[model samples]
Target: MTLIVTSSGRPCAFSEVVEKLAARRGEKLCLGEVVEAFGDRAFGPVMFFFALINMMPWPPGGTTLTGAPLLLLSMELAWGRDELWVPRWTERASVRRSTFRKLIGRFQRGLKLTERLSRPRLHFLTGSFGQGLIGIACVFLSIVLVLPVWGGNLLPAVAVGFFSLGVMQRDGLAVIAGWLLTAATVAVLFLAWRIIVASVSHGFDWIGRIA
Candidate 1:
């Protein structure tokens, strides 16, 4: 396997990143250190990590914890910033190595499948302008993720995850898939909101009738 080393001397590929984390499975990890390890190419993988965390079936409040970082990263991307600048508070965030290792392990199979299908193509769609568009979509989705909408964060998280993968791999086709997923996410959320409103209105009418 071709190993592309980052400035921090860590492997740049997603699988290699996972392997590195696994090797340190019993140690403590800070978010900042992880970001630094990715060096100049921090945005894509870091954002992908946060997005993936939100996509997992973690405990309540996990989405908000992860989504905030995704929001910040997306904002930086949209602003055309060449380097990622995470907030000090966010940088200080820490997690157990075992937890991260388990998370990676759980998703490894799917990640491998995606890697097999991904290749650098449709270069225009993965350029700066396209990244900006993706950032905007991610911003919207991250907001949804942070909200207390029950069962509503999954689709957006998935969309962001796909976008992250596309960016990291320089695969424009994957980016296109992400955009399609984003569109579907929006439609699904709108329909769900409408249904909720209708249900609430019906409940109010029934209450009025009883009164």
Candidate 2:
């Protein structure tokens, strides 16, 4: 489980972290190991990774597994915590290495392109106060993602992923983009919930008439 630490004592790039995870292609990849791998650079990368899993076309209940971490991380960020801490149950949660590798490969190219375009700008937005705001938004989005709303997880997941990337790379532009996407996600979820409520209400009215 030993990994090479960069001169800065953390993985220099998110892709390198993925590569390290990929290298253990047949073993169980636990969240604790990932937390250890990121060391001092835990929050952004881990949040990005968890949200990325939700963004993918994975099996049902994926969010159930991923959403908890997002919630925990968001709370820490909002609280201005410098270090991440997860419960033992969460840390012990894992996925098969081969599955993780396949998932990473699926989106690696697009992520690389994003990396190329990203740069540190708008420093104020990626700073502590800004991150606290983003984290508050993430807490709401994470709850939305965990719900069983049909086809509801994608937008929030993408928004959270972008936010994580923005923080990781200190790309203020990306953080702005993430905020825009989060707004859109919230709007869509609100509309969806309204529609569901209307439908349920109509159904109950019809049942009352029948009786």
Candidate 3:
């Protein structure tokens, strides 16, 4: 559920925002401060902020930290709210400066790569109605992302990243790509569940036959 930047020359790269946050003098960077720093571009940048947090292996409990905001953002966006808001406890969430630094290198690569390629095309997809659908999709993706499921977090995370990037940049193509990925992720999870269930049923049948 993370996203975008502007032509404001403020370094629209999500990684750059992480860099600035890391460069701050404080030992810990609060989630609220990150939200405020995003200004009018709050939706995309804020989502990306939490997404990057989720993407990283560091600072531990990364899923919980990022997932909560992702959920909040999804819900708020679904409601057509312009401003981003999280509960006081969620806002108070923080990450260490050193940890953010550790995440910068690889994380920046993926975000910058997409940023360079993505432009606002397929406008119809990012319109108000489209965004409401995206919010709902993101809500599902965020829930799956936080779950300790068999398919793991990577695919769902990538899907959410695309959704965030698409909405952030008003790039409809990217948003479509996100929906494609989201579908694939859900399919994979469902297949995995089916396999697990079949395997368990087979084991139970064998046990009964042997008994």
Candidate 4:
């Protein structure tokens, strides 16, 4: 991989790459441009991009659209692909430059603290085996993210984000955080499902009694 430095001559961080992409001149930013900008060996940033888009205040099915890419990416990572390759159709997918800027700006602000806290320290967890494990977990998380369950997407999205950032920066702590959050997300989803089921059963009982 090539070393990319910022204007201050320091190695570029994930956030820097995001900001650079956001600042580009265009009415719309195609997914191809984004892929080309990061190139290969930027698995974390590219996956993070897909995950982060789910946070946008989009309409119903928004998470499904954004989360689909994460599933494909996680599958590739799980299979231990050396390079990232998105679908050809994704290259044609474009978002309004104004919307892109807003999302990127929000992302920068939201992740400032995370960026400060992250650094390359845990090499072992970011190694091939460890990343493979993370990729597997991300596959499940991405599935949950795309589900229509209430409040399901948010936590899974966050967990996937942590996993991506951790793998990118070689921060085992972030991966651990992802694990914990993933567990919590699952538990919450299960509880929500049970509650819905119970409520439906009660409604059925009430209807039967009235009849």
Candidate 5:
């Protein structure tokens, strides 16, 4: 499989690769045909791409909407004049396979709306809806990232990005993990927000008395 980065510099639709992996849904990407097709050495880069996209900020109006800048950033990081690969194991195959399956189910559910649109353009077009959501997600994440929130809002962005790539590549396992992570992140943020609000209110009351 060709893994060249797009002009925007992000790895091309991981969807295709993911799809191939999905066929082996009962097993791990490392266990069977996926390794044969993508090769054992390529696993590092593939997982790296998945994690990077998984953790990235979402595009505003769908992929095309806010994905351009992300693509550029990815390009700079992956293929810039000084580009280099940094390997990090995001998860094990056993865990990731289950996570990815769950994520794909969610993506499939959302696709119901697009399916009704009936316009091929509207359905596959990732620029508007995908990017818009991602953009909004990024802003939310930016706020959460600065706060003490665990996982932060970035998880959702990562989930969406992974979903996008996974949909394109048909990688259900990655998608599952993305969604799980996103959900966990959001939960953490909700808890943190409550804590911060309570602390701020307590602090204000303590500082107001002149006596």
Candidate 6:
């Protein structure tokens, strides 16, 4: 039901493949193959791509992302600007354009921050709340994807891919497994950050002593 049809109004899976491939390869692979080979589960791939896009860096002192082009970029990246048949959930269930705003609304319900986070949370972590959680990750990812930041898309992309695929296939164990993977990933990132900071601080201190 949440599956979006293509602009051409046919069942598309470009997005779905994007989600899956990103889970495994991030942006390293060829976009065209991903878009064309997605076969049936396009939403996943599209959502994954957006998740990565959402992490871009905008101007200084700005955390919000841009719009318009983000949607177009997603479409292009997922379906290729060529004549590829991209699938989108029909307009009946489609939620484009204001996707970021809608997600913030969902996250805000029980959350103190903006509600956008709620879409994915409700879709994957909790059902029966609003629309399916699949959109949560997709919309959130799309928000970050529109930004200008670097490396910002990785975590969210992976998270959304895992969550979306898990929910779509009804793989509850996979959901829990994803949580574990996420925790491990976070721990690794934190440790790496600490090491980098320590190394830099040590280097600066040594330089100062020598000077």
lDDT of all predictions: 0.78, 0.81, 0.75, 0.79, 0.41, 0.42
Per-candidate TM vs. native?
0.89, 0.90, 0.86, 0.87, 0.34, 0.39
**What is the overall TM-score of model 6 with all chains considered together?**
0.39
Instruction: Give each prediction's root-mean-square deviation over alpha carbons.
Output: 2.2, 3.1, 3.5, 3.1, 11.6, 14.4
Candidate 4: 10-residue stretch with minimal lDDT: 1-10
Report how far residue 185 has shifted in candidate 1, in Å. Answer: 1.1
Candidates in descending TM-score order: 2, 1, 4, 3, 6, 5
Clashing pairs in 3: 2-47, 2-48, 3-44, 4-44
Which segments of model 6 are wrong by more than 4 Å?
A: 1-45, 49-156
Evaluated against the true structure, the overall lDDT of model 2 is 0.81
User: For candidate 1, lDDT tens digit of each residue in 1-211?
Assistant: 1233464574556767766766764477777867766665567788887776777675666677668878888999888899879878888776677777888888888877776777788888779998999889989989988876667778888889888877887788778888998999889988988999999999999999999
| lDDT measured at residue 27 in model 4 versus the true structure, 0 to 100 | 90
lDDT tens digits, residues 27-59, model 2? 888888788777744688889888877776655
Q: How far does residue 92 in candidate 1 sit from its true spot (Å)? A: 1.7
- So what's the TM-score on candidate 1? 0.89
Best first by lDDT, ranked: 2, 4, 1, 3, 6, 5
Question: Which one wins on lDDT?
Answer: 2
lDDT of 6 at 154: 51
lDDT of 6 by residue, 25-96 (tens): 332343343344443345443443443334333343132333322344334433323233433422122223
- CA lDDT of 173 in candidate 6? 45
lDDT of 5 at 45: 32
Error of 4 at 205 (Å): 1.0
Error of 6 at 116 (Å): 31
Q: Candidate 4, which segments miss by more than 4 Å at Cα?
A: 1-11, 110-113
Expressed as tens digits, the lDDT of each residue in 8-123 for candidate 3 is: 43544566666677788988888777876776547766776676667664333447556777888888888899877777777688878788777776676776777688888999
